[model samples]
Target: MQRGFFVSGVASTMAENRLDNITHNLANVNSTGYKASRSSFKTVLADSHLAGNQKQTSSASYLSMGSQYIDTSAGSIRQTGNALDFAIVADGYFQVQQANGNIALTRAGNFSRDGEGNLITQSGFPVLDDGGSPITLPDGEVSGTNDGMIYVNNQPVVQLGLVTLINKNDIQQAAGTLITTPESNTESAVGTVVVEHGALESSNVNAVLAMTEMVATLRAYESTMKVVEQYNQLASQLNSDVGKIQG
Candidate 1:
């Protein structure tokens, strides 16, 4: 009976975690270049000693291992007709130089030129070029090719620095849409990814799916609470009966 209550309590915790992840994903359904997260659970087992010093193996409980944000899938591409807007059509990421001079990766291609003619992301992070340097463009009609070549005044200036990670799970989310990974995990993706100029990528979250998941998780949590409450009532009644007998 005690083990049943323990199982329900652990289940309730996992349900709460799942609900949180679903809510977060729903909130970012409209964010640019956003990826949805998923909560994972695992079952734990332990050995119990029964009568006569006999060992029995039984299912212990469930454990919540937290969530993982998936970034491999590409979001839907939308054309904004903006000269600086860009989108990746393949498995790759745009390189950006953070304020502290650390390199970060992102899928957001909504870019603009700063006062110094340096290309930057929406958050003002300088966009890197093929040579791992900030791209400084000349003032003119700006255009980017599918091959990531930046052209100004119909003249080729520099190529965009696009890369792919050996293991995407090693990457962690930074501020906004930026992602950071160890320098050793990155490699130059020269010809693997195709860039679409004059376009942007929408968030990969699905609202209907997230909402359904949230509802289910809430229901499961409520059920667990009921189990815990019933266990408490039974425990109280047994204690009262034992006291009356002793008296």
Candidate 2:
């Protein structure tokens, strides 16, 4: 009888966590270069038979293992027609120097030059070059090629620094559209990533799908609550019946 209530409690907790994740995804549905996250679960069997020599008997339970973001999927690319706007055509990331001097990776190519003529992201982070140094562009008509080659006044200036992660799990959100991974797990993506100037990458989140998930999760949570309530009533009745028999 108690095992039934335990299962219902676990279910309720899991549903709450799932709802939080869905809500977060919906909020970032329109964010540029945003990635959606999902929760993962696992089951643990507490049966005595499975435990062999365990002293206590317990029932099976579900566990919320945690969550991870979907990073490999590419979002839709749209033409912005802005000279500084850029988008990656394949698997790669742009390297940028954060305000704290730490390096981070991002798919957002929407860039602009700062007052010092240094190429930077919309958030004012300096864009890096192949040498891991901030790129300083000369004042002129600037253009970028699919190969990440930057040109000023028809003269080739510097190529954008692009890289890839050996393991996506090593990455963590640093700021708006910016992610950072362990430096040891990164490698040069010279040929893997193609850059498109005058374009931007949209968020990968699907609004319709997220809404559907939210509805389903809410229903599941309600169902679990009902189960919990039923178990509580059954427990109360059982206690009352036992007292009557004693009397």
Best by lDDT: 1
TM-score of structure candidate 1: 0.89
- For each candidate, the alpha-carbon lDDT, in order, equals 0.85, 0.84
Clashing pairs in 1: none
Q: Residue 63, candidate 2: how far off, in angstroms?
A: 5.2
After superposition, which runs of candidate 1 have C-alpha atoms over 4 Å from their true positions? 51-53, 60-67, 245-247
TM-score per model over all chains: 0.89, 0.86
Cα RMSD (angstroms) for every candidate in the order listed:
2.3, 2.9
User: How do the residues 111-215 of candidate 2 rate in per-residue lDDT, one tens digit apiece?
Assistant: 899888999988888999988999999899988889898899989999899998899877787677788888998999876688988998888888998899999
Question: In candidate 2, which residue ranges exceed 4 Å CA deviation?
Answer: 48-63, 236-247
Q: Which ten residues in a row have the lowest lDDT in candidate 1?
A: 58-67
- By TM-score, the best candidate is 1
Model 1, 58-90: lDDT tens per residue? 645456455565656888999999999989986
